[model samples]
Target: MPAITHEAEPAKLRLAVIGSGNMARRFLKQLPDSRRCVLRAIGDRDPGQARVLADEVGHLCEGDLICGTEDEVLTSDEVDAVYIATVHTTHAQLAMRAIAAGKHVLCEKPLTVNHVEAMAVVDAAQHAGVRLVEAIMFRFHPQMAAVRELVRSGAVGEVRHIDAGFAFYVPSDPKAATIVTPDLIIPDAGGLEGRLFDPHLAGGGILDVGCYPVSMVRAVAGAAAGVDFLEPVSLTADGSLSGDGVDEWAIAQLTFGNGVTASVRTGVRMVDNNTVQIVGSRGTIELLDPWALSPSPRVVVRRVGHEPEERAFPAPGAYALQMDAFAESVDGPEPEQVSNADSLGNAATLDRWRAAIGVRYPFERDDAVIPTVSALPLRVPAAAPGGDRAGTGRIEGLDKPLSRIVMGCDHQPDLLTASALFDHYVSLGGNVFETAHFYLDGQAERQLGRWIAARGIRDDVVVIGKGGHAPDCTPEAVSRQLVESLERQGTDHLDIYLLHRDNEDIPAGEFVDVLNQHADAGLVRVFGGSNWSVRRVAEADAWARANGKRGFSMLSNYFGLAEPDDLPWPGCLDVCDAESMRWLTERQLPLFAWSARSRNFFERADPADLSDEVLVRCFYGPENFERKRRAEKLARDHGVSPSAIAMAYVLHQPFPTFALYGPKRLDESRAAFRAVEIDLSPEQVAWLRGDQS
Candidate 1:
C-alpha cells in the first residue's frame, strides 16, 4: 500500500516498527515521516506496548499508524516496510517473516542465530522476492562512510588489524534504555549465543559488537562478500566465557587470504560506548561510535608520513537510509549493502568462530522426539510461601506442577558426567527434563526415551524440546523432530512441545497448527515457545482460540537470576513482561525458564560452564559478585552453597521456572538439587535482587 506522505503530492513511505521497544521507537521518532517516509504501524505481542508506542510515534509522526500484531503489521495494507528492533534471537525469524510478508525489513545487527539460519534467510528472501537489510543503523552515518572511504582510499593504508570497543556502564534507567527486545542473551548472526554476553550468542567480544569492526573491514578491506570460501589462513582466538556460555571480552587474530590480518575485541558488561581502531601497514584510523556515525560521531586517520586527519560526512540515519534502499529495491535489484552476502558472511563468521572456539549451541542438532508430560501425582500449586514447592524456591503460581533446574543429563562429548544426573535432580525432587531430538546428536533424548520407557514415570516429569531452523517447521518436521526427541527419550509422546522458533514465514497460525496436530495425535500434551514473543504467541493463541483448539499453555523463555545485558531470547519475555505477566498470571499458562543461573552463582553449583560472556557479568560484576557473596553468606547461614542461594532466588518468583543444568561432574548435579530445598525468606530474595530496602 502506498504510504500517506504529508507532501502535497500525497507521497509517503508506509513503514512498520517490528518489536516495538527501544531501537524501534528511536528508529521511528527520529525519522518522523518527512516527505520521504511515513510510520504506518507498530507491531508487538503486547498490544498495550504497541498501542503506547503508536500513540507516542503518532504524536511525533506525520503518518497514520495502528498498534497490531506482527502478522497485522507485516501483512497490513498500510505497511510497506519494517524496522525491527525486536530481541536478537528472533532477528532472523522476524526478518524473514517481514520479508516473506512482502514487506521490506531492516533488522537490528547480528542477524540470525548462526550462519545456517543466516543462509536460510537469504534463500527465503530470494525465493520470496523481498528486500532485507541488517539494521546496523550506524553504518549509514555519513561519518561511518567517511571512515570507510578514508580506509578504502588507502589513506590509512592496507588495513591489517582492528581494535573496536563498544561498551557502557548502563545505569538501570528503566527508560534510559528500553528493555532489550530479547534479554541480552538472544542469539546473534554468529549463531554463537542467545544473548550478547552469551559467548554463543555474542560469538565472543569481536562477534558481539564486533560486527561493527567486521563491517568496517568490509568497508576498509573491501572484503564482505566472497567470504564464504575465505578462511583466515591462521586464526588463533583466546577468550573468556561468562558463568553461562557468554563471552565477555574476546581477542581473535585472523590472517585473510591476502596476508592482511585483523584483531578484534569487545566487552560491554563493564562499560558502554562503541569505538573502532584500525591499523594498516601504512597508517591507522580511529572512530568513536563508529557504528552510529551521525551528527558528529567522528573518524580520524593517521598516515605513515602525515599528520592525523579528520574525515567527516553528513550521514543519513542508517535505518532510514536502509529502509529507503529497501523500498527502492522493490522497484530495482538487490542492495549493495546488507545484501544476501552480508547475512551469509555474518552468519558464516559466527559458525566459523563456533567451530574455532568449540562453542556448542542448541541448534547443532536438527530433530528430536519430544516426550509427553503426564499428570503428576504430586499436588503442586502454582506457588508457595518460600517459592514454588518444586524446590527451586521460585514462587510459581503452582507447587509440584513441575520443577525448575531441569538438568541436561544426556551425554555431551565435553561433559564428563553420567546420564544418571537426572536421578540426582530427581533425588532432590526435580521433576522436569530438557531434551531434544538433536540434542547430543540425539543421544540425550535417547537416554531420556530409554529412561521413560524403563521407569514408566512419564507422569512424573515434564519433557520439553523445540524445533524449526535451517529447515522448515512444518507439521511433518514437527512430527519428525518430536519422534526423534521421543526416540531419544524412549517415549511415545512429549509432555510439552516447544517451537524452537516461530517460522514467521509460514504464518504463525500454521506453525501452531503443526503443534496442535501433534497434540491431537497425542504425541505432545501442551504446546509452548522456546524463543517466541507475545505477538507471535497471540497470533498462535488467536488462531487457536478462534478455532476452539488448545493454544500455548506454557512459555519457556530465557529467564534467569542475573542482570541481562541484552534481550535473552528474541522477544523471549513476551509472556514474562508486564503485560504478558498479567495475562499469564491469570491464564495459568506455566512460565518455564532456561538459563536460570545466567551462568553464574550456583552453590554446590559448579561454575557456569557456558560460552563466556555470562560468566564475566554474573560472577565478576560488582552487583553480581556481591550477590554471589551474599549467596555465599546465606549458604553459610543456612548451611548450603552460594549457588543454592542463586537458584533459590529464581524459585522465589511467581512463576513455574525450569532451568537447564549441564554439569560435567555428578556432584554438581547434587549441588543443583540442593537449590530445591533452600527456602529463601523474602528478605533474602530482596537482598539477592539488590533491593536493600
Candidate 2:
C-alpha cells in the first residue's frame, strides 16, 4: 500500500497535536509558519488541556480547532499527520493508532520504553506505508550535520573515543522552577512529581536525558565507521536511583563494533557540562550544549599541531528543525532525518544501559498491573472445513473449546509466515495457537494479535498464552507476565493459559491462587501447568479443592512415543515415565504433549543424523531407538510415514492427549493433518511399542 496522503491535497499539511504537556508546548512555540504545517486538531486525555492547546492553535491558524478525544483527532479527515508528545509508555500505542488510521506519525522519543514495543510500532508503520519518525530533535539540528561533516572530513582524525554528558539539578520541592507553580509556568497537575519521578510512566534520567548522549556517540561512531550507526559490542552501566526507585543519575560505558569506545552520562538531580566530546588520535571536537534545547552552542576543535579553533553556531531551536523535517517528509517522498534504524538502534542501546544499571520501569518489572481492558470485538470462529473438528476434545472449566492438535508459533518469522500457517491450520481444523511470553521476545503474541485482528476471527480461535517460565515463577511474576501476555495478544481474556515452566521453590498452592485470581476476573478461562511434575500437580489440586479455586485442568508435559535418554535442556521435565503416564491414564485429565514426536526422532531415517543436539541427547537411548525402529516398521506395514505413526501413538494413548506440532511449511502442515487421520487402536499402539500384549 502506498503511504496515506491527506485527502485535501492542499499545499499545507494537516497536523494534529496529541499532547499539551511542556514538550508539546515548546514544540508549538518553536514551530515556524513557513513549514506549511497546519495545526488542525488538539487532543489530550484531559479535555481542559486539549482545549487550551486548541484555543492557542485556533488563534494561530484562524480555523476552529477540533478539541475532542484521541479517537476524534486520529479519525478526523482534516488531520494528515499526528505529532505525539504523550508519556513514554503511551508512545508506541498511540503511534500504532495513528498508523492504523492511515496518518503519518512523529512520536516523541525513545520511540518506546523497550525495543520490543519499538520494533512492533515500526513494523506496523512500514506495513501501513505511513511515515513514522521518532522525535529525536537533535537529529535535525543543523549543527549536528556540521559535526558529522567535520568528523567525516577527517577533522577528527579517525575518531576512537567519545565522551558525552547532560545533567541538570532540579530541586525536590514542588515549587522548584522545574516543577510546578501556575504563576511560574502552565498549570501543572502532577508537575515533575506526577511524571519525571514516576517509574510507572517510565520516567528516569537515562530515558529523558541519557538518550542524547547515546545518540551523539552512535552518530559519531557511525561517521567514523562509514555507516548510519554502529552497534554496541558491549555495554556497562551504573546509576543512582531516586526515592521512588527511578534512576536519578546514570552513566554508561559502551564499546562499538568499530572498536570505538564511548562514555555517556545523564541525570536529573545533578549539574554537569551538557556537552559531547569526540576524541580521535590526531584531534578532538567538542560541542557544548549538544541537546541545544535552550541556548546557542560553541563548537571547538583542537588538533595535535594547530591552535584550537572555536566556531559559533547560530542558535536554532531543535524542535523547530524537527517539525520542518517532519513536514517535508509528510509533503514529499523524502524519508525522515532520523531513520527507523537510528530510532531502533538508539532504543536498543538505552534498553541495554537500563538493564545493566538495574533501572527497570514498572512495565518491565514483575509487579506491573494489568492495563484496563477496553471493549473490543470478540473473535468469531471461522467457518471452514475441519475447523470444528480440530477442536474435538472438551477440557473441563474452559468456556471456549480447543483443537485436539496444538500449533506452536515459536519460529514464525513475520506476519506473512504466521498468516500462512494460521490459515493452513484453521483450514485443516486447528484453533489453539500456543505461545509463551518469552517466545520470540513476545513477538509470537504480537504477530498472532495482528493476524487475528486483521482476519476478524478472534472468537473463532482459541489463544493459549503461557508465561512464568523458570527464573520468574513467583506468584507476582506469574501475575505480571499474564497481564503483559494478555495485552500483547490483544485480548481481554484467554481461553486456556499455562505456565511455560515451573519453579519448585515456590509452593504449588501459591501458583494456583494467582491463576485463580485471574480466572475470577475473566482474564483466564482455564489454567494449567506446563513441564510440571505429577507430584506438583497433585499438590496444586489438593489446595484448589480446599480453597474452592480451579486447579490445573490440563498438563503440558514432554510426552511422545520416543523415550528420552537425557534432558533436552537444563531444568526441563520429561513426564513420560511409567508412573507419570499411569497417573495421567488413571485420571483421564487432558494432556497437551509437547515435542510429541520426540522432536521428529522417528521422522528421520537416521535418528543419529539429527542436528538438534538437545533432541539427540534426549532421544538417543537404545529403547527409544528400538521403539523408533518398530514405528518405522509399522509405518511400512500401514503405508504411512513413521512420523505419523509416532504422532498416532501419542493420540491413541489411553489418556486424553493432544500433540503439539510446529510445522514450518505447508507440506509439513498437510502431513500433520494426515497424521491425525491414521488413528491407531490400543492394540496397534502397543504393537508399535514392541509390546505384543
Using TM-score as the measure, the top candidate is 2
What residue runs in model 1 are displaced by over 4 Å at the alpha carbon? 1-11, 33-35, 60-63, 169-208, 223-234, 270-273, 354-693
Whole-model Cα lDDT of every candidate shown, in order: 0.60, 0.79
Residues 1-693 of candidate 1 have per-residue lDDT tens digits of 997866455445677788766667667756743345677788897878899887776775454567888778778877777877776566766776676678777667777656545654555566567767776656555565566556656766666776655533322332343222211322222311234544334334544465665555544444322232244556576555566655555556666766566665554444534567788878888875565445545667788889888766555566667666666666677665556676566566655555565555543332322111111122223445654454542223222356667765444442111323444345456677776554667666656655555456676677767665335556578777777666655667776677766566677777777777788888877777766776677788899888887778767666555555555334434233467656655666566666665554444233444445545433445565566667778888988766666666766765555556666544456566777777777777778777883
Clashes of each: 107, 5
Lowest lDDT 10-residue stretch of candidate 2: 370-379
In model 2, which runs have C-alpha deviations exceeding 4 angstroms? 1-10, 178-190, 293-296, 331-336, 369-693
Write the residue-wise lDDT of candidate 2 on 1-693 in tens digits.
899886764477788889898778877877653355777888888878899876665665537778888888899998999999888888877887888799999888778877656765776677578888888888787788888888888896888899998766556776755532112232443376557789989888888878889988998898888776787889999889977788888888999988899999988776767788999989999986577544566789999999999976775577767777787877566453588878888988998898897777765543233221111222244544743454367788855567777899887765645665666577667888988898888888888887777677787778888988878878898899989988987889888889888898889999999999999999988999988999999999999999998889899988888877776766677778889989999988889998787777887636547567776767777778788888888788778778878887888888998888887654456556667778677888887776783
Superposition TM-score, candidate 2 onto the true structure: 0.59
Per-model TM-score, in order, reads 0.48, 0.59
Clashes of 2: 5
Once model 1 is optimally superposed onto the true structure by TM-score, how far is the C-alpha of residue 496 displaced, in angstroms?
A: 33
